[model samples]
Target chain A: MSIKGTDYYTIDELMAVCMARTIKNGDTIFNGVAVPLPFTAIMLAFKTHAPESIFWSGLLAGLNPDPPFLPPTSGDSVMLHRANPILHLHQIFDLAMRGELDRIFFSGAQIDKYGNLNNTLIGTLDNIKIKLPGGAGSSHIGCFAKNYTIWSIRHDAKVSSKGQRVFTFVESVDFVTTVGRRTSTRNRDELGLMGGGPDCVVTNLCTFDFDPLTDVMRLKTLHPGVTVEEVLENTGFEPVLSDTIVETPPPTKEEIALIREIDPMNTRKVGFSRSALEKRYDF
Target chain B: MGIHSSKDKVCSLSKAVSRIEDGSIIAVGGNLSAREPMAIIREMIRQGKCNMHSIGGAHGVDIDLLCAGGVLRRVQNSYVGFEADFGLAPNYRRMVQQKKVIPKDTDCVAVLMQLRASVYGLPFMPMKLVTGTNILDLHPEYIVMTCPYTGEKLSLLPAVKPDWAIIHAHKSDPKGNIKLHPPYFADLLAIEASQNSIVSVEEIVSEEEMDKIGATVPYYEVTAVVELPFGAHPTSCYPDYTYDRKHLAEYVKLANRGEDVFRKEYLEKYVFGVKSHDEYLELVGGHDALEELTKWNQGTEKWCELLGRNL
Candidate 1:
């Protein structure tokens, strides 16, 4: 719960910083609807490390919008405040098809070891227990974008309404809303997916990267104060772990300040649960 | 589909919507919350339009309200929720869960490709993505095949020709020359691909004025035009007004309370109770509240305040 000798920050801030760090300068990045965390991270990257990166607003279809403040909704007109050369929906898709899209960020209800995502449903298709808002473009973006990052605010296992233990990180997602490195039968290469699948997964508990050889998720770094045992216990499937499991780097003072500036109203925190919002870090 | 070349295509809101029969596939324009043809949608509900198949890219209250009103039998949409403002759409989720409505959930690109097939007058369109995902399984209309030219696997999406495409725009001529501002999210596609297109505009201008503004959707493509100011209310119509967040919040709250409460309180009070769009506007808050939404043009502070952001 506490990390000694570190600057004060919230878990949301830390996760945002970690995700922002993945964006390289000049990379064309896009985030899906309702993704406040990635939105904050992209803006943070613009203000800090990757100012040259292109921010293609998903729902708004704006390119590199300079909004006064982070709006609660992604498709709000505020996103198009100073956005120039606004693109049509087809144009954005054309970019993805032409292999011009560099990066994309998305999240799902369930993620398997291979990084396949399921935002469609929980139980079987016929006997549906829970129906999620359908994946808008995650299926296409996951397959087309040069690389994508899967992020989540929830990391732990919880009991479903049906009294079944539900793990966010599952062995196999109930439905594949977005394909990752490998499916039940074939790998990404064999499946002819243009994108490199998910490069990394940033979560409240830890960060994971797919193993190059096996195409399975591997523990890359643990969030500060998150124990390795805690992550292993929470994950539904066993993930490959490095011999030296390092702590995820906390956001620098400047990065935290930039995040605060970009999201003055703490719009980034809107996606987090009330209890998760209360989880604060201190030196 | 024949071109609608009539000089004056303007008609009453009810008349415009009446062209769309029950069990018709309707493609509602707008992405998520902005620029949704809410007034027309309200009219459809009031007229008791039912068993309609709905299609869109991203949507919130508009489609959710349609589900709430028992207006749809199937939804071929990419998303249907209130982004981060609220969480999942209550009525939509409830209906889909109970199997009252079929969830033919689609990807945005997939919808675009399918609609493009219709626009291009093709039987089906070949797509590279979505081959590995389970969305193909959900959409049996999508056929997986090896490309003859490249020998690459591709998913062929059947043309999705909606019966009507409903849109709300900034301005229009009497002949239905629609002009919209930036962030035209697939509205043009929806209009072009559908068998018939209906548009409601905030203002009705002359042909000269429309020419000066540059029509986004020409009169030939449009079947009917209705001059319904603030037609995209509750959602947004851009420069004219922003989304009524407080009103939408109230809607979400009522919708979340379940079917009975939503039907009685939200639907009855706002939708069924109002005789017309003006009545609905008056019920929401009248001129004073609408003026407040237009304050986004004043400055960033006012804009932030409008969005309920405290900085």
Candidate 2:
């Protein structure tokens, strides 16, 4: 049962898409929090060291990525699992300011033509009215977590640029979370970004990976039945289309069970859409 | 440096806490009993570490010792409940009520901020959440004002970098290399946010042993590594294969009875009597004593479960 590409994807599928892109089995990659994606990336690794594992680092220095390994936000015993912590998150920042983080995924309040994020506030800094989730941690962390950037947009929200969303009566953040190549000003040496702004925008439609230059989110992969045109139509900004757009793999039974049964918090509240799946995806 | 695979480190009950310095920010790692370094934390209590800063996602025994010892200066935690309803964590709740330990009204942002700082190696992080929120203004300790280039007001919240992160884990190698299976305590951020770390382990193998298994946390970052068996006493996870039931019940008894009462009967026995986890076990006196203690702990846990609340 799917609407748009929703019927073809699951929350765990989104989780997996994000995790698979960022974490390697034993890489000591650092992670940030507020959601399970990064934590899942760590836990999913076969070579993770828990009860001592640090998050939000750039490299994967002997990190444990085991199945049963707990997510970082839990407690001490969960995080202490580690291997050779090549460097702490603080040290990793040296890489970040210098542009070293391999993959970054921070939620954005708005996204635009180019993938610049607006996680800080819903409205302008002055005469402020609506405030979405604060960007205290996400703001700086986003600067570092570069490779696999993402913004989890609800299927129902109507906003401006992913970078400039307007969620309230007043002008809130525009719709863009990760700007398309057409939007972002490119500058890595001076801490500027293009496609790195929002490499992937995860929504009900499907996953879109941004081009390094254009910042426009190219259609990386569609869910089992999602169409490129449908995704493009629903998208606020015109997304960059990858040379060979692919289809998202279907969810395995185990993935479904984990999404529904084990995680009660429903952190990723995505379910397959009935209509999206029932209809054709070749738009 | 390493653990003897066969021998459990000094099997016993711990009462007194030692080795904890005053005014240190200590991160307690465990949830209920699954993955906390309970024994070492108890040891810190026996050592009489005062004016302490304690942090945890969900703490059980460690909170008890810190509170009972009257050593808490500040507490940053999500929630604190003994095996049963320990009457709103007297040391914290009472202190908040009586203005002893000031509860810095904050939310989940600080937790993420600390991890972010540690992750990035920044001294303090400039965040966007606490700004314009009560948390920034409410806790004088966390607030700072900044003037943006555009002639606007911005508040800067100093980051939380703990002095030491004390945690107990399932396995580790000689060089303090650790292995966490799953459902671990919140070690990622706790370790990330702290300046230093100490690990008390259930079992320690050789470095080769750790290597054989695979990657583990390097020992260089860990200042102290001890092989303390039953390390997480009063905690329900490893060693003895069961939770300390009666001990938990005792905590609840003291909790329900009130802080003063908790001090007299329960804290006196557990918090004051023994210094080491071993001593606490010895004072447990025998198999029957141990069994009885666990029974009560389990009962208290059930009672708390039945009541179904932290407050």
Candidate 3:
């Protein structure tokens, strides 16, 4: 295992900077509500590397808003002022339906080896189970965005449960809230979906990408102080490993400054669950 | 002359809600908490309108408040939650999970297309992206048909014409011409698709001001206009004010405790207990807070500097 300045950065900052780098300049992104991490990362991208990136909030359709602080929800109207090229939810969908969206961000309570997401429910529809906030636009965004990013803050037994975790990553999710690339290319063609499926999965501990051939999730990079053994132990399924495993780069001075500038109040700092933040202290 | 017969076009919030029958299917404007017609929603709850249907791609606080008051028999929306970071909407989740309200889990595109079909005066619209998903299974009402031209499989969503569309605006004239700050998320669509539409505005300006602002909704499409300043209340009206996060957080807190607690604390204190939007506004804060809010909305007061420090 390799290490980078161990105590200088938090896992939340690492995840934000790593995810920020994935966003390219001029890329149009559809950011869903209830996603504080990705929303902050997108703002970091805009501030640092991807200044030209257009952020489309599904709630307000405010494109490229200079949000004063990290909003409680993506639907918060505080981001409305100074927004250019404002849109309706339907217009955002119109872009997706027409295959115009370049990237979309989604978060799920559960993700699978194939990157299939579930934010709908934990068990059978009739008898009952833990009911999650229904997939708002994740399904359509999955089918429409050229590529999508799925993330979660919790990466322990609760999120990556061995067998009892029906809501977390599994062999098969209870409901397909967001389709992964595992669906045959021919099937997507038949369904008229243009999306290529999820590009990567960013968790609190590490980053995972899809295998080129099978679309199965493969370990891409481990965060500082995290070992491959730990990732394998935490994940539900056997994730394929990268050819040469590397440490995910910690937040650069510039990234830290920019991320902090975007979130001056440390709203993002408290985004992690108390237990998850406590676990990171060992790192 | 106005676009419609201006025979009593302007009315009180209570009067506007009085027109919405108990079993009516209503399309609500505003996205999430922004531009939500909170005053009208409170009025509806106060009036005890029951068994109503709500339409939207994803409903926010307004619909959630209505659902909390047991005003909905069924909701035909794509999703209902406070968004990712805000967690689940307490009342809506409780109602659906407890089998108190039937949820028609449709897709945002499907809902929009259904409204679009009505706007276009079409019987139904063909969609290519709706195949191969559980949405069809969830919403069996949508008809799947073969495309006539390409011989390809397509989904046909029938027109959804709501009986009344309730919307809020930053400003409007006496004639009901509306001007939003921007991000017209489904508000214009709702106004056009409904058989009748009522508008609640933060302020009423002159017709000339509406013309200069380039009003999005025509007076012809509107059924009535209600002047209710700070109409969105806890939600934002854009250039008027931002959402009162503290107030909403309190609502979420009380609502999450349980249905009984929410009904007692929130419903009793906020909705039914208040006589009018003015009373609700005063009870929530008052003229002093509103003055501070005015400064905040105009960008003169930096929320990031003031609230950011404590947050």
Which stretches of model 2 miss by more than 4 angstroms? Answer: A1-283, B1-19, B56-61, B82-87, B141-155, B236-250, B282-311
Which whole-number lDDT from 0 to 100 does residue B186 have in model 2? 56
Cα deviation in Å at residue A162, candidate 3? Answer: 14
- Maximum-lDDT candidate: 1
- iRMSD, per candidate, in listed order: 1.3, 11.5, 2.6
All DockQ scores: 0.72, 0.03, 0.49
Task: Provide candidate 3's TM-score on chain A.
Answer: 0.88
Q: In candidate 3, residue A69 scores what lDDT? A: 69
Runs of candidate 1 exceeding 4 Å displacement = A1-7, A160-164, B309-311
State each candidate's clash count.
1, 126, 4
Model with the higher DockQ, candidate 2 or 3: 3
> lDDT tens string, model 1, A63-162?
8987767888888877776777788868888888878889888888899999999988878779777888888889887889999988988888888778
> Whose TM-score is higher: candidate 1's or candidate 3's?
1
Q: What is the DockQ of candidate 3?
A: 0.49
Q: Is candidate 2 or candidate 3 better by TM-score?
A: 3
Report clash pairs, candidate 3: A33-B84, A34-B83, A34-B84, A34-B85
Chain B TM, per prediction: 0.97, 0.74, 0.93
Candidate 1 lDDT tens digits, B1-311 = 34888888989998998888999999998877799999999999999999999877878888999998989999989889987678888999999999998988889998899889999999999987566788777788888798899998887889989999999988889988889887888899999999998899999999999888798878899999899988898987788888888888888888889899999999999889999999998998999998888888898778878887432
